[model samples]
Target: MACGALLASACAGMPDSGDVEAVKASNAGDSQVRVYAVAPRDNADPEEIVDGFLEAMTSDDPGFATARKYLTKRAAQSWKPEQSITVLTNAPHRGQADRPGDPDNEGRTFPLTGRRIAQVDVRHAYRPEVPSAFDTGIHVVQQPVGDGKTKEWRIDSLPPGLVLGEADFLRNYRAVNKYYFASDENWVVADPVYIRQRQDPVTRMDPVTQTVKALLEGPTKWLGPAVDSRFPSGTELARDVRSLAPDDQSKLRIPLNGKADRVSGVVCKGMAAQLLFTLGDLTSVRVEQVEILGSGGTSLCLLTKGQAEQEYSPVREPGRGENPYFVDDRQRLMTLEAGGRQPDKPAGVPGPFGKGTVQLGPVAVNRTEDRAAAVLDNGHELRVGSLTSDEELPEAVVTSVAPRLEDRLSAPSWDGRGDLWVADRNPVKPRLWLVPGGQGERVEVGTPWLRDGTRIESLRVSADGVRIALLVTRDDRTTLQIGRVGRGVVDGHEEITVKDLQDAAPRLESVTAVSWAGPSRLVVVGTEAGGVQQVRYVQTDGSTSATSVLPGLNGVTSVAAPYADQSAPVVADSGNDGVVRLVPGANWQPVAKGGRVPVYPG
Candidate 1:
């Protein structure tokens, strides 16, 4: 008897009690249909055992107990399903079974093949890769059955972890942002990780609990060097706690183990903030306050939503995000009144740039909206001036002599620390420079990867000043990469560098425009290989959900997002539609007739 035949007979005898559900059909295969694997029958063939084991791995069996039935006892004991995950573009294909050496041997090996698109390591960190060939093998051998009278085939050698198709992986896993503080700064950074959408089989923990555990485990490898966690070493949920929920007052109380019992009140409050931010989007529970409890169930510290915003938030003032500026037809700076009163009307900025005195290109405003930086003289000169007063234009803080205007300088950006950053894309001497307080002497930042004809086309500094988004062009192909911003002292002098570059949008063949949409998300304009243009949101860890892709647009030249406001619209410059903005649940609406570049203060 085969595995499928045995499963059919066993299911026929089971009683059906649950409500009958409908499975909607679509062009894309439905992931709602649950899969349940059955044990391989006695005297099963090698091919049956191999196929049955693969099918079992995709089912909902607890601990994959059914899958182990088709594997040898030794193999089952050594296999660690949670070690890692390999995501394929589709279900793996099995090749014909063949004996290792002798044709009469009972052992046979089957090859598993597919196109791998991404991988999740033991730490639950997801890394996207260019689609590539995936090849592996599974070996099975004849084994003795009851009383050693009959022989059964069982998998003897197999991979250590689970392999899932894209659709199934999407259904079973969810992307979550784990919060960690910037190494030297108090601001928290988002470290993305994937967890089971449903209850984890081995841990038997709910989704919220799983995310909390992952957060306590600390940051991912790529971001570990730049961020720190407030949770004490070896700190975890109190033993015997299975689920967490808020009380009637919307306050969630998290009980930690003994390791966290000795922390100071300040450190405890930081831990509460980390917990609040980490669980912000993971659950529907309205958590207005987080109270940390010691091992003995005594409250150590408490942090409210309002308190976290005022003290440990990325944006100190919520009002700073309302002023979004853009470059108009006359090459002047203009601001949109987005405070629910005359939302579409454009007003002139209060300075000389608003009076059209200087022809500006790409522009960036300081976080306080009191200062602005622009590329003047067709990108050859970088200028910074006050936006609140009609003061004379300041001298050029930086200049480039690249022969062509296009190769002179990229857009200028301001981080939350009031520092200015820009890249000179000159082929002869490419460099990245940072100006402290937008007035200090520019310090050249080292970028070792900018070599062999590779130049930065554009760059956006994250609001935390700990990460930067770069559009790097090499061999005529541009890709979006996120690099860590390191600031420290080297041999007596202060040093700043951007290092540990990771591809943030691996699926896009080329990226033309990119901006930081939130702490851990980016709005990018790019296209996949052999595909049309697209606008999408990609996580810093290189993961995207099914709904990440936005609606189609004609042609997007630049994209900008407000880091402080999640409700603010995404502004973009379109060649065919002029300036437009995409608000939630609405289509793109025209903002200006000839606006070229729209930007929100970082």
Candidate 2:
């Protein structure tokens, strides 16, 4: 009989007591078939009873008796005696639980639990040629106990011959439910319930074949070779597909956001060679203007195209207000203030003002909106004119009153807002000053480094105004000092001197350049005895720790933060190799060449 048919019949309720007794009488008709009435005892040893049943099944002597030990009447009647005892010469050796199976073994024994043998059925094959040891098949039914109560069975018809490997058996059979049986080699089984609930395709096709067919049906066609041009264009279909895909579709909507328009530029130095760039899209543009207070005075120079234009001239006298001024783009003329002081002379001519010097400081302009900020020298700052000049000359209005800064006031580099930082070497104490913008509060930071005649050669503020790097020269050696600027006038600043850096790395000469790597990281580039050294510092716990990054540079003159997209900083060396090598991640590769000077945004 087929396995399923046999299972159906055997799984039916046990035969009636009368039928069982009749079968028992017929089997006992032979004088050799002795049977005993073994009453069920509450304290019967299940192991001992099972051993007695095994002995009865295996023994060949006709005088041997059968015991109904622990089994119910129906179960005892279902058992049958072996007809012959021909022990197979090639029977497998029984193996220990941990050891691999021996080649000549019928099966091995494992500890049976209460739930494992709750219900059992036995079948006997009476062929004389077959070995008695392998003649019987034990069908064990496992009934769940404890929290779960499901019934399952293991049918032992064929000898266990490593049919399922130990790994596979443990993965499937150890769990009451065959939860792990559904896995393939690669992925875990997907949600079986969800998969079953989905409607199956009417015409079944392999997934690969279906994908290939869809690809062959061209994107424009909804089905087969017939193009659905009336439904929607191919471009529209592609757009819809992209829209349905993950991630933002707004990034894909190109040329709709805004067009690139020239905002404004200022000519620095002589307005002939160098120019600073501002953009209509300052959000995307990475470069920022680095504000520098010239030795002369502070004046706003708008760097655009190849020229820098002085936006508004500063008022030289203290407390004297200057008339509003504007710049004409087409004629390049400077008009006097409209309501304020009119020029006593012709336009472009200095009106009571000395030869006003202009510096390429920070200049912000909105070309689309035609708004601009013209930072002026002599402490005065103005906002003037159409950032994009049309017909009338763009006018300049004083927005900020000039602070009474010391002689030779250097323009403070703006960090974000309300904070202006400047480094000065005028006095014996050359320190960094943090001035609160629009409020005129000043706080000096950094330790006193300058002795009798020492001076500060250079000072640069970080992109974020939190850190100030200064190049100082004393009697012994020129040292670099880095200090942190606090938010207010409180003196809780932290300073790191060259002496501290020497303890970190001994072989160093002078710090030539220092720039902020990121918000909290600073890159120091200087000359050492070996060559040039580049060190990166991370601020932690109100202090800075330095790590040596690049060594053996042939005298680095300047260093700047890398371009927005680039990962490495640009270092200029006097070794004449005019190449901007990009250190992407960790590897160094040359990107741009020629201009070795570092250009920092204000």
Best by TM-score: 1
Off by over 4 Å in 1: 1-34, 99-104, 319-321
Q: What is the lDDT of every predicted structure here?
A: 0.83, 0.29
lDDT assessment of candidate 2: 0.29
Q: Estimate each model's TM-score.
A: 0.94, 0.28
> Model 2, 376-470: lDDT tens per residue?
44434432334233334222232232234332223334343334455454453355455444224455554544457665555555433334555
Report how far off residue 60 is in candidate 2 (Å).
69
Worst 10 residues of 2 by lDDT: 187-196
Residue pairs with colliding backbones in model 1 are none
Count of steric clashes across candidates, in order: 0, 29
Error at 207, model 1, angstroms: 0.9
Task: List ranges where model 2 is wrong by over 4 Å.
Answer: 1-412, 427-431, 438-454, 460-466, 487-507, 530-548, 551-555, 562-597
The root-mean-square deviation over C-alpha atoms between each candidate and the true structure, in angstroms, is 3.2, 32.4
